[model samples]
Target: MLAANAEEAEKFRKETEAGDYDLLEGEIWWRDRHQMLIDHGYQLRPRLRPGWEPSWNNSNKNPLYCEDAHVGLRLAGGGTIDAVRIMDGKDVGIRPIKRVSSERTIFKNLADAQHLTGQDQHIAHILDTFEDDRDPDLVFVVIPLMIPVWFIASSLKTISGIVDLFKQLLEGLSFIHSKNVAHRGLWSYIMLDAPSMFPRGFHPSDYFQDHSGVHQIKVLPPCKASGPVRYYFADFRHSIDVGQDAKHLIFGYEHPVGADFDAPEWTAIGTYDPFRADVFIIGKIFNEKFISKYENIDFLSSLVEAMTAKKPEARPTAADALKRLQTITSTQSFFTLRHQLVEKDSKEPESLLSENINILLDVAFHGLKIALKMPSRTISLVRRMKRGSKEKETAK
Candidate 1:
């Protein structure tokens, strides 16, 4: 419904024409839309797109997403911090998600992004805290998400679904970069969502006594058997041991925090190279997002890419990395559960020439027209402003 003119309205209509526009389904409370099992706080689709709900009453449960509780406290320096209870096992070698926490450009404020970890939806959320000179104790700033009893253990059915979810993580990172904040804490948990009903190792899900570990048992992760496992980063209380004023390496998705996620220029002055440090970390996320995991080669290549740059300025920003991923997914061929991924030979001279010709024609026909009109449009805008100003001056 948000449109500047008939052209925009028609564009919206065309965008939906490719896919049937189903009124998004969910419940309505206080004139607000709420999904099944989703916290009443959620206002849009679980994936966080903007759309309208049909009647505000969908299934009480969509078996798709989850959420977590809030954490952290405020500090004297205006920074907030919180802590997560990291399970001893399930992850040991896994590193924090990203390096250098930030919020403006690359990061996002997910109402329930924190709770999607280890459940059906595959994602990890950034949560928890760290120390700062501005505060006497770690600051707890963000609200934790609450996961549903269902929507756990999403299946790896299609790589596209996973990719779609994963790309959102990059969007969050891009949002962080735009804001010029660092995502010092990135990981499987922080990037993914965590289920709340998972059986604690301390508490077994026993229908009957299992003295021999042979009881009729179900090993359902706190998640429903629908999608891939989600992850959520906890313990932000220690998130910034070396970040912020001091630039500590927050841990989760990356293997080694500072050295691995840091840029080339940061090798010597990482403690002070905050922006470059963040960009290097983002390159790692980009490589993994577009390229499938193989041997440690993926990790190694990411390391080389993120750190090999001569300077942090030479490194790619999170937004830049997202652009790379966009090109990769839209153009490059990659293996999936269904498709055979392979690179087609671009050196086929005839095909290449034909493609180039088509592109040239399209640009000259459509793109060039739009480009030429933009300057005239700007001139018109300025002319309108000047005319208004003259009228105001004459009245005075």
Candidate 2:
């Protein structure tokens, strides 16, 4: 893989110097087999089509201003691509994996578990898999196209959003752990199924644009009003199923130590419990993306600290963390849950005032929706909070 990457880098260098950048050197594979992919029920973008000419070519307008200019927009990983499923027209991700890799076996296990137990709700489902006709040793895995967790989290304005996100993450980890599978890397693989949030669907590359990569995306409503937003754990390349041997320890990985973010215990020297390492990875993700950035979410400080403890044995299991989160959140009132989080670095006092105003307006809208018998998760959450408060009062 290292040699292949280096070869691609060299090709890229040559293409840059030649001033012939129609298609990226790495993207040549997709373009070369465009018709083959189409015949297999996936449609690549216009830019990737064979014999296609750029619309911006010889035009007075800047290429950057044209939608076709974004052909170079690709995921960090080189082999993966975003395409539209020909049958349903829904966007999907296509990733190639060697036949000998464990990823295919892991996905099969997850799929079986999801079908029988229905506990794989937080895990990404593999849509389809097909062999590459050119290389019998290579196969492409198709998955639902999901937005990055950070992107959806950044759009969130209230504590409910953050709480819900963490709950799903913890629940996901717990489910995978229950199956005796340890996801050694958990940071960048976390994604959200938020198709409802964007009415027109978003471009896989430039999320700010619509599916066509031309117009700006149109969002429907805040997460609270948009029904339940489901989060999923993707990328099981580094994951391992210990089966009944939950006590098994991993020596190290043949690949990199971590999946984008390195856990403290992943020194690649000695054997360590991958399950506990998974816990720390989740904690690191939450801390880096949320706790460190938001000032008002201090309620998670102790939980985060415990999950990221230096001692692998000291960190709470995914189940424990989920329960702790529920207990912590249950005590807060609906108004408190609806409280908008202030960014720690947000020095502007007026921003807080604006957030407060938005919260009030959201509450009013939710109340109106409730009165009209319209769908609102906020109403359901408020009712649960009320019930909890009543239960506490009776206990007292």
Candidate 3:
């Protein structure tokens, strides 16, 4: 009986060796500290847990076809991972950073800040922070998990949706500036908080797929149906507090990097104001993402041009930029705000058909509401249209 048991154990070991169950070099760090993270009230996926065995090992089916085959794939950046809170079953982002890093310090300062208001502050909130058990130099920070803002913004159908998105983004930048801080690395760090859009949740490794990695996630539009979404500034790894006097010039990297490399000052001779560089970066993002693609939203033309001006000194301050945006948005009519955003080029036949169909449906629905004299929203829209027409005639 002992000899038979030994043979069975050896066969199992050989099968495990042949299969791809072992953790990769990049994933070993997380697997090693998996138990420590669990003790801290977070649990990694089953694959990352110790003593994990491939569920399809004994089966005749190929592991590649199994649902659990790619459960805990590591993200591109080595320091970050997605985790689940054991107490409340909420999703959270985990990142291990140096204990004395500026990123950690900025997160602490923002969390403790009293002057920042809830309405205008759009930075990511730090949920928890703790030192790693084995590494004194490393600390793990927990924050709300969010997808890129463009994931939500790209699918928007109306001008009003884009306006709301930019408003929140500008307000967030302005709020950060108010704290005497400049987000040296902008654009790429902006994220969206819209849990309702993905009611079924999603796979951490593959955001386009469901949590089980079996099917595509049904992404809800960022309309009234999905509830209002907020944009936030995240990943302050390149941020710095420039002091209240605002005279500091940063000269770190010898070469241009990040999304704002096109900014004239990034490759200039000496140091440059990070604040103005931030504005230029935001403009580049806005133009590349929206203005350059969409035919409408011309109201934002002047703002984008000024923000991306060749000279950094010519750019508007965050506060001034926000004020300018607010003023321009205020002058827009109800129809203009609610109108379908036409794309500059719809080369794909299917996309053109879908866009045109959506435009027709939106126009019909709004026209029906106006014809029915539906409640306060409809009435206000009518009043605004009339006011806009009167203003146009007066200008003429």
Candidate 4:
């Protein structure tokens, strides 16, 4: 759900409080943390009532033990453009960091990845950091407000649209891997719409209202030209640097289990290449979300199968996977073949002559039934004509 308007959010809060719903343990934690952030000059946007929930890993049984909290926020001074802070009052996004070590690591990883990617359009840009003065554990990281990829995918009307999104994700992942970073947690939920475009079909006035009872209208940004929309990879909390050496082993004995996205190798005993695990995550996502659903996108079938191979060694490197994707997309004949197959499958089989004859007889029977009622229709029309003539003659 999109962020709620101020009035709606306030009403929700009041209702929750009145009903004693605000006293729930999760709600209490959220309220306290939220107030702390507000006290430190970070202004959060009104959250959508039904959709906003505590960001907790399913593996973690305790609701209060949250490592990261997702919320819509903005800089106090205003919007910052291109790394420079400005005062335009635009809404940004924030993800709270619960652990001091995790916060430091994430900040460093984001900065290093940014340097490596360097204005690459597919990577989510981290804007700045926020910290609470009183609490050492509470830290907030700011980023551009992005529409979720699942939201965008649901709106997509064609196979080509899904392909476009997948390609962008591959490109971003390739870049990250090239920089020797492994995004341990890569899934469809972590992908987001590009910052350059507004939320699909959104209007500012829909969320904002004039208070003085006067009609207030404002111009909105121009719609972007129709093309492949850009997508970015977000949520770097589980990310790590793998260093320059490709053979460098990273141990994952302490890695949490039970999540579907967790690479199978992590659960097995010894050290594993984090980069290969990243590829496995991406492959799993592609196979489950795209390949399994759409038959025409069989071009990616073999590639996805290989990337998701049970053995970590069998999976392709991110760079190799990207190269294969480029090759498949560049082949125009594959798309032509796919179109032909889809068109052929969509065509209905020819009906038997007996069926056609039955249809014709049904049409004729209906026609005769209508013809039987024509005399009454004609009588009504003649009476109406006579009545009109009498009225016209009287008027004359």
Estimated TM-score per prediction?
0.34, 0.83, 0.80, 0.60
Residue 186: error of model 1 in Å? 5.1
Query: Residue by residue across 1-396, what tens digits does model 1's lDDT show?
Result: 135565755654554444333322221121121221123122222222334432212222211111110011121223221112333212111112223353211223332432433332222343333222223432223334423212222432233434454455556555544443454554332433433223321111121212122233233432123334443323232122222444434323332344423434433632344545655554554354434332212322543374336665566666665666566566433322222112233245675466455445544565555556578779799899999999999999
lDDT of each: 0.36, 0.77, 0.75, 0.55
TM-score, candidate number 2: 0.83
**Model 2 poorest ten-residue lDDT run:** 56-65
RMSD of each: 20.4, 8.8, 8.7, 18.4
User: In candidate 1, how many clashes are counted?
Assistant: 97
Query: Lowest-lDDT window of 10 residues in candidate 1?
Result: 63-72
Writing each residue's lDDT as its tens digit, candidate 4 over 1-396 gives: 222465654554454446422233433343455555555445432232234543322232222222122121222122121111234555555555654665357555656666665666466667667775456776666666555565444444344556666677777778777667677764544655443433232221121212111223221211222223567776665677667786857886745344557788887788988888888888888777767765567877888888888888999888898888878877745233223122213434443344345345545575575566579879789899999999999999
Pick by TM-score: 2 or 4, better one: 2
lDDT of 2 by residue, 225-331 (tens): 45557888877888888878757687754324536766666776777888888888788877988899999889988999999999989999999999999999998
Give the number of the best model, judged by TM-score. Answer: 2
lDDT tens readout by residue for model 3, 1-396:
121455665665565677655666656678888989999999987777788777656544444434555745555355578889999998899988889987788867875562345443787877888899999998998888887765566667778888888788788788778788888665557887888778777777677777666577767766534455878887888788878765768763532355543567777778888888878888888898899989889899899999999888899988899999999999998656866677886557776667566656666687675567568887899899999999999999
